[model samples]
Target: MKRRKNIKTVIYHGSIWIIGLLMIYPIFWTIASSLKPENEIFRNSASLIPSIFKWENYAQGWQGFGGLSFSTFFLNSGFVTTMVVIGTLFSSALVAFGFARVKFRFRTPLFVCMIITLMLPSQVTLIPQYILFHNLGWVNTYMPLIVPAFIGGTPFFIFLMIQFIRGIPHELDEAAYMDGCSTFGIFWRVILPLTTPALATVAIFSFYWTWDDFMTPLIYLNDTKLYTVALGLQMFSDPSSVSAWGPMFAMSVASILPQLLIFMFFQKYLVEGITAGGVKG
Candidate 1:
């Protein structure tokens, strides 16, 4: 029995480490490529270690086209991401609170429709959304990327919040009501605080989704000045001819740092939120 248990333990840990390294290898490769000179990249593509580390790739990439610094792109991405995180958290929490706590006619039907919308691919609504934004004069502006967030946010975030809210006992809500809290007051003071872990999860998801979004910004933004980090990365490439391989890898490595740092800092909350939500459901 002891021999069998030891064999199983060794196999389990061995498989886990193998999978872990496999997942992390791409990130390690990108960083390694960023350090290699353009010429050395393909010359030593098979090797993980670089013969000559070109630190200048970062500097060259930062000196962006049309006199605009890469700092401009990072800043633009930051602003839009911040707006999205704020809007998604605020709006989704409110809507989820209503769905979880409030009772009203047609509430089930409305919630069902909202949940059904999640099953539809975003491409299905792209044309209609584009037309609406165009009519509203939101095209060629960040409004197209930022405004929908405040109105409703994503269905996934809303659903997560709803599930989280349901996990909290109804007695706390009743106690708040006895203490003269209104519906909004109960949500603000009672449910929101208890759902801290879940909210953190939502914020992390929102930040990543908004930061890494390339297509929406591409469709809505026209000027080079308003371009984001994702767009900035693309600026290095010209499919018709030569592309800046070294600099693209350097910036790609840099772009990853922010998200890695955010996730590292919030990892505890993220794990707690996901595990708790899973258990509750």
Candidate 2:
């Protein structure tokens, strides 16, 4: 029996390792290709080892085009991502608190409407949103990309926060109210502090989404100097000409570092937040 159990454990772990490697193969390939000479990139794409490690790919990629370095794109991405994350957390938390705690007229209907938006595909609203932004003279600017986040653009984040907030005990709110805390005070002093794990989860997700967003940036940003890393990476490809595969792969690897670090640091909080949100008090 023990031998059978040990065999099962080995099989389970072996399967998991195989799956993990398969999932990460692309990333390994990208990294390996980044260091390889351009001629060898596609020629020996299946191999993890490179014949010649061309360290200059990083430098070439960083040099960028039209007098703008890749640093500009990184900075632009950093700024936009930072603002979006802040806006998402602030707006989602405030809106979630209202729906989760404060009782007001039409509140249920409004919550229902908000929930309905979650089911609507973003592409359905894309054209209308673009026209609206265009009319508002927000076309070709970061406004279109960044403003919606501050206005609670992501219904999913609000929904996540609402679920997490609902799991908190009402007695805590009552205790805070007894201490002369107003509604906002209860949220600020009590609810917010206790929702740390959820907030971390939200922040990490917000960072990831905003950083990786390509379509929105592609639609709004036309100036090369104002491009984000996503757009910057796109510049490396030319359908009519030879593409800079090595530099593109190098930049791609660099682009993933921030997300990898974020997940590594906040993975615990992310798991706790997700599990906690599903449970009720």
| TM-score, one value per model | 0.92, 0.93
lDDT digits (tens) for residues 89-145 of candidate 1: 898899999999999789999999988987789998899999999899988899989
The TM-score of candidate 1 is 0.92
> Which candidate leads the pack in lDDT?
2
Q: For candidate 2, write residues 107-171 as lDDT tens digits.
A: 99999999899889999999999999999999888899889999999988898899889989999
Minimal lDDT window, size 10, model 2:
235-244
Candidate 1: worst 10 consecutive residues by lDDT? 235-244
User: lDDT of all the models against the reference?
Assistant: 0.86, 0.88
Name the regions of candidate 2 deviating beyond 4 angstroms: 241-243, 272-281
TM-score of 2: 0.93
